[model samples]
Target chain A: MKDALAHTHARIQPYVHNTPVLTSHLLDELAGATLYFKCENFQRMGAFKMRGAVNAIMQLSVEEQQSGVVTHSSGNFAQALALAARSLGVAAYIVMPSNAPRVKKEAVLAYGGQVVECAPTLTAREQAAQQIVEERGATFIHPSNDLNVILGQGTAATELLAVQPALDYIFTPVGGGGLVAGTILAAQYFGRNCRVVAGEPATMNDAYRSWQSGTIEGNDAGDTIADGLKTQLGDINFPIIQQGIDAIILVSEDEIVAAMRLIWERMKIVVEASSAVALAALLKEKTRYAGKRIGIILSGGNVDLSKLPF
Target chain B: MKDALAHTHARIQPYVHNTPVLTSHLLDELAGATLYFKCENFQRMGAFKMRGAVNAIMQLSVEEQQSGVVTHSSGNFAQALALAARSLGVAAYIVMPSNAPRVKKEAVLAYGGQVVECAPTLTAREQAAQQIVEERGATFIHPSNDLNVILGQGTAATELLAVQPALDYIFTPVGGGGLVAGTILAAQYFGRNCRVVAGEPATMNDAYRSWQSGTIEGNDAGDTIADGLKTQLGDINFPIIQQGIDAIILVSEDEIVAAMRLIWERMKIVVEASSAVALAALLKEKTRYAGKRIGIILSGGNVDLSKLPF
Candidate 1:
């Protein structure tokens, strides 16, 4: 796992930013912990999802590359895959929900992805992507379920751990489990005393429930402002998450917004509500993590300025 | 001038952020120049003013340090002085206009500065600061006119030039002329071919008119969305400005707001309208700077989010 991660880091080094690690005296005082934020929000395509997308596309064979790649996503991953494919000189087919924001669709197109909109449902998205794969003979790359993508996502944690080896905890927001699983793998491979922790919105606490019940659980209604963490854990990444993550912290919608505002106002950095969940989780469990050195993955900075919650 | 700037850089090295240089492919495509942003908005107290404040306070003798320091600013410099003084374990007296934003006043207090509110006029602010100086024997540190403050402000450009010495131009928003004058000195000393340019709001184009007429000019009514760049150049900094600045570009209020939005949305960084003026000026003169490497000073990020123009 360590060797694979190191290889991924080397492969993606040229294509992505190493992204700076930022600290705040005010944030440290608030959380009562020494915090190191890995600013992947400043990543290419403005998200850590770019890391996985690039990795997945890079692993394709010459023939597979010629055939191109496809993915079904309406979020950062959609833009990530498009940008990664564009950088790697491959065709990309994006299957986005019809109800997705026009801004997001335009962003995917701007990144050179051929967008194929479908009914705003999982089944419809999968069907559209399947049709693309069948017609073009392109390989379908799952956003987070693929082994290569998970290995790629782990590189962020690897870089963080490489710099701050003595971190007591590493926090990441749980979505399709790609980031948390990758973080776990990196911590397992490189960390000295670091334990991987997952932060989930209480409104969509599937990951938290899944850990407690020892089974995968989906949210009854994905109604959180943390739009990134709405998806449930997948079979490919769930077992890794279950084994690697020390705990899953759940935070309210208000907590998520408050944390987001704090980062924007105090740190003067634009981070999405999903990215704020990691810091929110740490703030929620301030007593446990007080005075400890911790790392947080700021997942992305892609947010619509018109609809700012603050 | 170079020796003084070097000394100021070393003196304030432990007190302020060296700040990151950020670039955007989209922004580069929009402006013909390759724009490198020296992000002083990310500096301590969220402004480049911190550098000047720290340097000015550090230059004081033990007897003067015991007497403390005072400044009259209703903007970023007030917070900068307060924070710098607190960091150095010295008392700070801030004279703020009575109409200053509650948030700005709170920030000054939070930084351990004693805020004295007076009428909303330059004369009133100076009178209040004078009162503090007379009563407490505090040394008045002019926001941008003092030689020490100007030397301190030059350190940002020094750092930027040290890293990218071959830059063709450096853009800064001009108000009281400290930043532009300091940048000119740094470029003269450190840069190979870099020239310093000033950006000012058309509503308050004192710097631009002053440069054209070979004399200091003051705005009749300081009215601009970029509240920071409304002040006129002073005696101490005006001569330096005349000697050092290559050009001063004037931008409209609408242009300033549009540029500010572009930076907020694309760069995912919270920068005040004053910071945006530098980019607006570059964009306005895109043809001249085509394919050139240019550096822009993002003056500050301390803004009232509730009153955001975007």
Candidate 2:
């Protein structure tokens, strides 16, 4: 797995940015811990999703590359895959929900992806993407379930650890389980006793429930402000998370909004509510991590301006 | 002047952030120029005003320092001075207009500065500040006109030129002319034929008209969306601007808003409308800078979230 992450990092090196690590004195004072934010929000497609997308498309064989790739995503992955495919000279088919934001759809189109709208449901999206794979003989890439994608996602943590390897804990927002799983792998290989933790929105605490039950669980209501963490874990990455994750911290919607506002106001950086879940989790248990060095993965900066909670 | 600027940089080195220079491929393609944005918005107190505030306060004699510093400002400078003074262990007396945003006032208070409210007019603000200076025996630091302040502000461009010396032009927003004056001096001393340009709001085109007439001028009405650039240039900095500024570009309110939105979406950074004026000017004349390398100073990022134009 470590070797796969290294290979993925090498493959995607030319395509993505080694995004900066930012620190805030105010945030550190508030949390009673020194925090290093791995700013993946400044990543190529404005999200860490770019890392997984690039690696997945680049892993295709020459024959498969000729046929191109396809994915179903209503968030950053849709744009990420389109951009990665376009940059690598491959055609991309994006299966987007019909009710997705107009701005997001336009962004995918601008990146030269062929958008195929489906009914706004997971089953419908998967069926639409499966049809594209069959008709075009293209490869279908899962946003977070594929092994290659998980390896790619792990590279962000790998990079963060490369800079600051002595961190006591690393927190990541868990949605499809790909990022957290990859982060755990990277921390296991690269970090010196660094424990991996997951941050989940209270409204969508499927990952938390799954951690306790030792099985996959679905959310009763995915009505969280942290839109990126609304999805349930998949079987492919669930085992990795179970073996490596130390704990799952659940943060309320109000905490997520407050954390987002803090980053925007204090750091003067634009980050989505989903990214704030990780920081909110740390704030929720500041005493446990006091005087410790921690790393946080700021997932993305894609947000609808009109819908700003503040 | 160069020696003074170098000294100022050293004095304020520990107090301010060496903010990152960000580049957007999409913005470069749109403007037909490679643009490097010197992000002063990420500076202490969320503005480049911190540079001047630190230098101005630090230069005081021990007796003057004991007496403290006083300034009249309703913008980023107020918070910048407050934070700078608090960091340096000096008392700060800030005279703010009552019409200033509640967020700005609260930020000043949070930074431990003593705020004295006055009527919403320049005359009242100055009178209030004057009373404080006289009664408290505090030193008054003009936001833009002070020599130390101008030298401090120049360090931003000095840092920018240190990183990229071959830039063809450097653009800065013009308000009281302090930033543009300092930037022009920095370019003159350090750059390789880099012309300094000023971006002014079209509705408040005092700087543009002043540059044309070779004399100071005042705006008929300061009705621009860029609130920070509404103030007219002062005599102390106006001559410096007249001597060194190569051009002054005027942009409409709509153009400013469009530029601001583009930055927020594409760059994934939270920059106030005032900082967007420089980019709007460059975008307005893309044809003039085709394939050229340009540097722009993003002056500040302190904004009231509730009144966001977008």
Candidate 3:
């Protein structure tokens, strides 16, 4: 898996941007750690998921490529898959809940995704995606629960290490776990003694609890502003996470909002709440990582301006 | 004046960021033009005014530098001067209106500017600044009217034209006239047949009227979200803008907010209302420059998230 990181990166290089690494003196001073922010928010569809989305779609056979890809997500991954599949000249069928924001649907549609609206339920979305797969012979790509997607997400960390080779730690927010799993893979194979840590909402800490229990865990409370991290971890990314991830740092809602505000005001970048979790986790234990070079993967910058916490 | 642009840019290079030039496929399609955005919003202190602040402070003699610098501004220039003077190891006295937001004052103080509070009136702010200059032997640096400041602001356009030569037009917002004047200077001196255009609020159209009447004009409407562009042109920059600037495109408040939102949502970057004025101006005349290369300077990204118009 480690050996194939570079190959996967190369395959997606043409379709994804080599997003810039950004830093801020104010954020560093406030957090008490030197932070190198991997700005995946500037990715093609405004998130690092683009890398995984493109990589997964590219790994398909000629017949599979023509059959196209399908995903059951209304988040960043939906837009990422749509754009990625379109870039590869393949059709994408995005199974989105009818209750999803008009903006999200329009974004998926704008990216050439064939939006298949379903009832506002996971079963409905899954059923719609399954129908597409059965009828059109389309391959279903799990947003963050697939090995190929994890491999693709690792490239962001790989690119980060290439620029700033000797980071003390790489931090990412734990959602369905592709980004963290990918980050851990990068740290294990490519980093210079670099460890991988993750941030999770305290209210939705399935990944953290799973790490503590040495097995898969689930949290039913989906009451977090970080709309992306509510989903429980998948079995595929869990074994890899349990093996290599250093720790899962949990942050409060206030902490999350504060960190997001700092990134917005101090760094002057638009980042969604989920993206700020990694920074929140770092700042939570700034004493532990004081003065050390840390790489924080800013997951995405998709936010509703009207609902800003500040 | 044209040749001086490079020297000013080189001098301020150490203090300010060589901000990235960004382009958006979505924005390009919306405007029907090839937009090269010089992201000065990413500059030190989160604005392009940092360039002018550093340049103006750097122009002082050893005696003047030792005596320190003073400015009356509650805007981005206050933070810019504070950081710039501090970077140069000089004391900065920023006389902001007492009624100004505490956040703005704290930003200046955080950047090492000595805050001198005065009544919320132009006369009081100026008097307080003049008193500081007389008593402390401090050199007063106007935010946008100064020649050195204009020269420094032009460096953004210089850097833009360097990376993206053969631009047909460079669009900038006319505030106190430093940015546009500097842009015109860069166009005349360094660009390859490039013409400089400006954007102004329809209500605060003093700069536009000044260009048309062949003399300096004053407008006191001041009814616009572009707080930075409410001021009229200065004597020093007026001549330069009159001679070289191609046109001043006026846009409504709704247009300004729409353009700003587009940059935020599409480009995934935070930009202030004044920065959006340039984009609004370009979009207003999108058909005129259809499919042509146009450079735009996003002046800053220091918007108050709480008061966002969207």
Candidate 4:
């Protein structure tokens, strides 16, 4: 896995930026820790999802590449896959939810990808994507279940620790467990004293419960503003997280909103709701992070600004 | 002055972030050039002004430091100076224009500075600041006129070219001419290949005319949404700018607003109106930058979000 991450890093070096890390005295005081924010929001596709997508796309054989790649996403993954495929000169078919933001759709189109929209349900989207894969003879790329994807996602943390070597802990928001699992693996392999912790919204705390019970817990039918975190944990990602993670903490919606507003107002950085969940946990004084050099992976920055008020 | 910039960079290395220079393919395509955006919005105090404030404050002798510092500004410089002074355990007095944004005034107060609001006229603000400095026997730190401030401001460009070594041209919005002159020195001293250019709104073209002729031109009344750039070029900055600056491009007020919207929508980065002046120059397709590796210093990120619709 470490070798795969190293290979991905080298391959994607020319294509993607090593997005900047930012620190704030106000944010540090609020979080009760000296926080280092790894701003993946500034990534090429405006999210860390590109790391996984690039890894998967680059590893494909000539025949597989010619056949094209496809994936279903609420937003970020679709844009990442589309942009990555475009950079590699491969055809991409992105299945997105009909309710996805217009900006996300525009980004995928701007990258020259064919978009297929389905009903908002995950099962409906998957079924639609599967049909497209069969009809077009395209490869269906799972967002998190693939080993290459997980290995590639791990590189963010690896690169972070390389630059900011003094980190004592890492906090990342868990959606489908891909980022958290990859981050944990990277921290375990690269950082000697760093602890890997996952943050999730209480409204969508399946990953938190799954980690606690040693079983895959089903999400209830409640909705969360963190749209990226609504998905179920992948099989490949779950075991890696189970092995490498220190703990998972859940935050309230209000906390998420407060943290999001704080970053926007004070740090002057636009971060989506899921990324805010990690900050929310820390701001709410989640134990194990006090008086330490804590690194937070700001997962994405694809927010509908019209939806947020100052 | 160049030697002072080198010293300032070394002294403030631990306090400030060497912000990244980001390349935008979309922006580059629009401008018909390769654009390197030196993102000082990510700098401490959410602007490049901190570099100057930190440098100016740090260079003060023990006796002078005890008496503290005074500055007059209605924008980023005030907040930056106040914050830098607070961090150094020194007092700061700021005299702001009566019409200054409430948010900016609040920020200075948040940093534990004494703020005195006077008439909106430049003369009135200076008079108020001078009175305070005289009464308290405080060192008056001119935001853009002082040698130390210029040296500190130059560090942005120095750090910029360190990461992105191949720029052929650089564009920065001109206000009091401090940023342009400082960047000019940095580019000349470090990366001699790069031609430093300044961008100013047609409404505030004193620096443009100053670069054209051998003397600084005063504006009777400069009107623009870029309040920070509406000020006349400083005496110390004018001579340096006249020598090193290749050209000064004029952008319209409407163009400035358009550039501001584009930055917010495409980059997902919040920038104040002053920063938009540089982008406006590029979007207008100015001849000097066509097909060139152009570096643009995004001056600040202190927008009043409540007034903006997304």
Instruction: Give the number of the best model, judged by DockQ.
Output: 2
Error of 2 at A133 (Å): 2.0
TM-score of 3: 0.98
Tell me the tens digit of each residue's lDDT in model 1 across B1-310. Answer: 7788898899899999999999999999999778899999899999999999999999999889898899999888899999999999999999998898888899999999999999998889889999999999999999999888999899999999888889999999999888988888899999997899888999898988888898888797769999998788999999999988888899999999999999987888899999999999999988988999999999999887667776
User: CA lDDT of A32 in candidate 2?
Assistant: 98
User: TM per model?
Assistant: 0.98, 0.97, 0.98, 0.87
Model 3, B200-297: lDDT tens digits are 99989999989999898988757899998878888999999999988899999999999999999889888999999999999998888898899999
Each predicted complex: what DockQ? 0.71, 0.85, 0.79, 0.44
RMSD of each: 1.4, 1.4, 1.4, 3.4
Report the C-alpha displacement of residue A261, candidate 2, in angstroms: 0.7
lDDT of 2 by residue, B227-250 (tens): 988788888888889999988999
Displacement of residue B188 (Cα, Å) in model 1 is 1.1
Which interface RMSD values do the candidates have, in the order shown?
A: 1.0, 0.7, 1.0, 1.9
lDDT scores of the candidates, listed in order:
0.92, 0.92, 0.92, 0.84
DockQ of 1: 0.71
Query: Clash pairs of candidate 4?
Result: none
lDDT of 2 by residue, A14-71 (tens): 9999999999999999999999999999998899999998999898998999998999
The window of 10 residues in a row where model 1 chain B has the poorest summed lDDT is B301-310
Model 3 scores a C-alpha lDDT of: 0.92
Candidate 3 wrong stretches, greater than 4 Å = none
